[model samples]
Target chain A: MSAVTYETEALTGRDFPERAREELRDSQLRGNIRKATTTIRAKTAEVTGELPDWQDLRRAGQAIKREAMRDLARNLEALEANVSRAGGKVHWARDAAEARWIITNLAQAAGAEMVIKVKSMTTDEIGLNPALAAAGIRPIETDLADMIVQLGHDTPSHILVPAIHKNRAEIREIFMRAMGLDHLGDQPTELTAAARRYLRERFLSAEVAISGGNFGIADTGTICVLESEGNGRMCLSLPRVLITLLGIEKVLPRFEDLEVFLQLLPRASTGERMNPYTNLWTGVREGDGPQEFHLVLLDNGRSRILADPVARETLHCIRCSRCLNVCPVYERTGGHAYNSMYQGPIGAILTPQLRGFAEAGSLPYASTLCGACFEACPVRINIPQILIHLRGEVVREKQATLGGRLGAENLAMQGALAMFEYPALMGLAQRLGRVGQKAVERDGRIDWLPPGLSGWTASRDMPALPPQSFRAWWRSRRGRP
Target chain B: MSGAREAILGSVRRATERMPTGVVELPGYRRALGLDPAALLDRFAERLKDYDVTVLRVPEAQIATTASARIAERGIRTLLIPPEFPEAWRPSGPTLVPDSGQGARELNEIGGVMAGCCVGIAESGTIVLDAGPGQGRRALTLLPDYFLCVVLARQVVGLLPEAMPRLRPAIDAGRPLTFVSGPSATADIELNRVRGVHGPRTLDVILAG
Candidate 1:
């Protein structure tokens, strides 16, 4: 990587502990999130209660997503062929750098200085906004939730509701503070109208619009977006140039498969029986939505993820935001705490794959392994399983490179791995620790363990070394030694 | 206009190619669902309500009466309906506008009206408009604040994938197809949700027998 690429893609350098501390400090955001999530959860429960077969829908969605990710290359090729035959341009981006370059050039090729964006998590994953800003182009957000988040210059907190961390009062404040519009009140109707009025002008004037698909139909070459606000309609249709940034996993086998998802997504995320707005376009029809449509199919870390057998299920996420709603950590810190565009359960697995571990190493550990996210997931992604797998990847990242100290983490990991490889060494170490525990113990807790052990004892009290560890007891009882 | 139109269509075709299809069949789907049709619709309606979408069920003959009642109850005037709608089906209190729009956006300006559709998904409670007859255009279902669709239970399809092959003829004929699931919604500001951001605030589905 060059200085320029690293300059853009580098981690924010906000260490995990600091980020967690600062994010946890926002008690108001936490309260707001708790209230909003609980409400949606209740609504979802009430609606899902009506469906005896809701679990089956979730199973079908999960199976479909799994198959799509497993056969990524072939399916994508087929999709490209169908879409090409129908009349669309597909750009394959290998990484964020490539994706950003292609998008900027597409906008530049159209000679557009201003662009409008739909609610797309993929573009944000590639940091498209900063890229546009860097290229002297502006991208405005059309999704009311997105617009509110953008106007506030804030990161999206939830997948379904990026502005979930904010309330009506905060929006009123953001508009007044950022847009300089006065007399803005807190009524939902008035606030929606205010956003509609602001976005109306942008919709009428924006030269291009950027979108993210809920699912890309492989057979019919159709792209789908399920939203509650008609704002998605304006963004998807009104602009002259339409650009869609979609992950490889977003594709489904057939256009008809949308039925299950259309049912599954709303109930899981917003607790709605159905999505309010679902737009499907095969290709540009005469005098219909956006005249010029371009699709950016991003690989970034997907190909790397595809290579992994056990962890590939991580890509099955549909971005329904159900996981985030159920995630205890997400409900606390919101989206920014993840420190990447993709956040929450899907983000925990996806970001490390797309962006790489060196930058997003902390993301996998940010979760409590609480299965609430997985339970809430419409497609039933086993996120906690993927989290442990990615943690292993992060631990073993010290592959032979021209590195200096090998990061204390890497050295500790290597030493542990070495000990695990030898039964004798493992026993020796356990015994040594057991003997050493007396020196460090205070009131049934390690008062001051070794430097590296600080992390373990920092929060909870480490129990007095378990008497004789199970291995020793086993050896003594079974006479295996 | 023709050349620019072709160019646009060409790009769209290219973008369509970017999507992937690797469909896998789920096991025992019907058995898992327990095969209770009416129960599923009830659950669907309940779920729609949870999403802040209004749900209303009426007999086929009562569609006009129910629609008129709903329009008046909601205080929605200046309603727009397709010219193709049966004369007897027109609501009594509202001004009905013809489906013909000088352009695509003309119908979106009207308040709300009923439209005919090709299929309805009972399991999920979605309405499909093949743009045939009273379906008008895509904007007819999308642009208004309160959208009421009269769907016969006989037209309801179990699946979209199953529904597509049947609608392929209309699609091939260049008819604009609109599949509506619920009313427009957004949770954009700090995750606080508000309904009807861009589409209808109220979606009333009159299930005709």
Candidate 2:
């Protein structure tokens, strides 16, 4: 990779643990995340639980995604052809820089000084707004949460609700200060009205609009965007030129396949039975929305992920954020802890693979292996298993870098391995541990430890070594020699 | 750029070729939904109502009267209707504006818009609007503050699977299709839903028997 590309894409380099530690100190942030996640989680469970055939729908979703990823080349070719036949241009982006270059060039070619955007995670992943700003073009976020985030000069903290970390008061403060509105109340209706009035002018005046596709149907060359707010629809409808940045994995084989995903995404993301609006458009028409259309298929690290047998399930993610809501770790530290465009359990597994182990190696260890994410996943991605797999990769990478020299962790593992191999040593160690426990024991628990081992006891107490080893007790009960 | 496309496709092909993906059976999905025709229409109306969308169930003869009442109730002045909209269903007293490729500026000035839906799904309270005769361009339905959609009983389907095949013709013609569940809304602020964002703030559905 070019140094320029590396420098640009390495935007999120703060380690997960450090960021999480800092985030845990914020009580207000924690309460906001807790309330938002609790509400969404309950609603999600209610709606998804109502479906008697939910498991069937999940399986179908998984199967459809797998088929699409497996046969992506053919489907993409078909999509390009269909889109071209319908009067839209398709561009191929090998990486983040290329995608940004293509989109920026498109905007410049259209002579658009500014563009209005729908909430798109892919664009955020590519750092498109910064890139656009660098090219002397302004990109306005029309989604209420995204607008709040942008106005506050903050990054998005959640997939579904970008400003879930901020409450209504914080939002009102943002509007009062930044939006030139004074005496704004902290009610949701007033906040939404302020955002609506602010964004309506931009929507009407915007010459070009950029969005992310939820599903790209190769059968009809259609791009589908599902949203609760009308901002996406406005961006899709008002602008004369529409540019959609889509991850290559989003394509489906047919329009019929949306049946499964349409059922799965809304419930999993926002816990709505159905979002307010679902916009599906194929290319351009003479006098309809977006007379000029472009679709940039981005593969910023997805193909590398698709190559892995055990880890390929990451591609099946629908960006639902259910895993984020249900994740205990996410509930505590929230999205900022992960330090990537993606967050929570899915982020723990996905971010490492997308950004590579060297940059995001610590992400896989962010999870507690609670398996809540797996259950919450609409496509049933085995996130805990992937986390363990990526942890192994990180360990192996470190070992290879060290040229086989044992690190402290490896030395500790070697000691444990030796003890496991020798029964007499194991017995001796257990007996010694009981005696050693007296120094640290307090009320039958060990609360603190030395530097290297303190992380274990930091959040939880370790039970003091038993007075009698199980093997010794067994031997005494059985009257063994 | 073509080179990039070739390389990417090559990588995908090589990657997928190594893994053995098994064929999956759909497993009686349609049978599991178990929706009846009349019940489906009622379910559709009920679901849309949950989103605060007004659903007016009237006999075919009362479409004009009910539509006019809804428009009058909303106090809408200028109304935009598709050129191919049935004259019998067009409400009186409001100055009728034809949707003849009106830009966002022109459309935004109108108070309300009325269109016909291609199909309605009961399972997910959705109305699909393909840019056809009765459904003008997408801008008309979107720019106005209030929207009234006309849905026939026959257009209602039990589930999405039953609805997709019917749109095959529209899909083949590459018409821009929009599936609207309710008026524009946001749950972004504290996860509390507030209606009326950029699309029509009010959605009134007239279900013609």
Candidate 3:
């Protein structure tokens, strides 16, 4: 088997728990995320409740995705042929580095000093903006949230709303500094207007544009992008040359499958019945939109993820982010804690699998396995199940290492297993535990312990050991000893 | 690039070697609204209002008069239209400029653009525009601040599923398509929806049966 090269720059340097601990201390971020998630949750519920056949639609969506993944190679080949037949060029990228190189070369070939961009997670995954800048091409983000993130020199914290962690006042500051405005208000209306004015000139002058595809129809060679602002329309239409980086797993077998996804995505993502604009194009047109178009099929760790049957369902995510909104863990810790472009329950499973257990092993333990994500998923990806499955993988990977073999956790588990196999040792240990509890017990709870076991008691209180073991009590009550 | 393509495909093929290869059957679901024509139109108008779009229902013969009054009310002097736009429906007050590969800056200077639609999805209140004869190109409806779309009642479908077949021809012809539900909007600022950001801010729809 060939070794997979996964994305490293986008993954986290620190473990999820440590990062989450730091994120939890930011009261402003907490407030912004809480308000945004709560509002979106209600909106999603209201719109989804209106459709009587929502469950059936979700089922159809899941089935279609399964069918797409089953013959992914064939579907991709068909998509390539169809797109090429329609006067568009297709490129294949094995990893993030290759994708970045291809996109930068294309930008250089176009002789573009500046490129307009539509907000796309695929580009974020590959860190395209920095790569473009290094190549001396100034990439401008046209989406309002993306613009805020770019101008502020901040990373996106949410899937749908990139700047969800920033409130109006913070956004106003970013806009003032970035756009060189003397005065700006904190109201959303004023902020939106300022962004419109700032991006309008760039949109008109942009010679090259980059975008991410939401869905690639294999049958008709069409690419679909959904957005609320007209910025997407501008990036897709106004540029002379266009380039789109699409994840290979995003391809669908037929265009009719949109009948299922188009209904589920908007409701799940932004809690809207439908977004303001959805742009679909087959390929290059004579005089309609961009004269030249390039589609780069990206396989950065996706094929590796497809190898694991249990984890392959992670590819079914449509980036709806409903899971994040409903997740108790994500609602509190937010997206940055996950240390990847993906966050929440989906991220916990997906990151570990894609980046391998070595780089993102701690992510699987980030969730509480509450199953809320599974319930909210449009395609019904069993996220909790996948999290548990990846957790097992993480443990196995750890045990394979020398540090893991002699680790405190492994030694403790081994000792406990030995005691459980012998009844006399088990009884003796229970008696010793009962006596040892006196030193730390206060009333009926043990709030603190020595260094080796204090980690468990740090955030929660443990009950005191009972006077008698359950087996001992049962034997005495039955008059058997 | 071809080497990378082959390697990726080979990896995928190996990964799915154990799985079955036949097509998976899609679930049977309710795909259509099943409403009558009148109800569909009513639902379409209602959904459009939900998006804050201006919906005007007029008789087929009164489209030009109604559009002229709206244009006057909005104080629009120059209106952009596709080359194949019906001459009978052209309002009298505005100077209609036919789209002819105008630059983006030039298109932005126009007050509004009027075009016909391919299909109107009633359930979602979406208007699909293929860059066909009357629709001109994608840039015509875009860049302009105001948009006026004339949707004949016959073009309205009850649901997204019903509209797909109507759009298949455009897909086959390889024309670009745009589905506009409402004027440009954004809720990225603390999840508060602010309308009219980038696309046409004011969407005036003349629904003439």
Give TM-scores for every candidate, taking all chains together and pairing residue i with residue i: 0.84, 0.95, 0.96
lDDT of 1 at A117: 82
Number of the predicted model whose lDDT against the real structure is largest = 3
Candidate 3 residues lying further than 4 Å off, grouped into runs, are: A1-13, A419-425, A442-444, A473-481
- Candidate 3 clash total? 0
Sort by TM-score, top down from the best: 3, 2, 1
Docking class of 3: high
The two-chain DockQ for each candidate, comma-separated, is 0.31, 0.78, 0.87
Q: What is the TM-score of chain B alone in each candidate?
A: 0.75, 0.94, 0.97
Best candidate, DockQ: 3
lDDT comparing candidate 3 with the true structure: 0.90
Q: For model 1, what is the alpha-carbon lDDT of residue B70?
A: 86
Q: Which is better, 1 or 2, measured by TM-score?
A: 2
**Runs of candidate 1 exceeding 4 Å displacement:** A1-13, A45-50, A108-113, A133-137, A205-207, A399-435, A443-447, A450-452, A466-481, B1-25, B31-79, B87-96, B104-109, B157-177, B189-193
Residues forming the 10-long window of minimal summed lDDT in candidate 1 chain A: A1-10
TM-score for candidate 3 (chain B): 0.97
Query: Model 3 chain A, poorest ten-residue lDDT window?
Result: A1-10
| Predicted complex 1: DockQ | 0.31
Interface root-mean-square deviation, candidate 1 = 7.7
Error of 1 at A379 (Å): 2.5
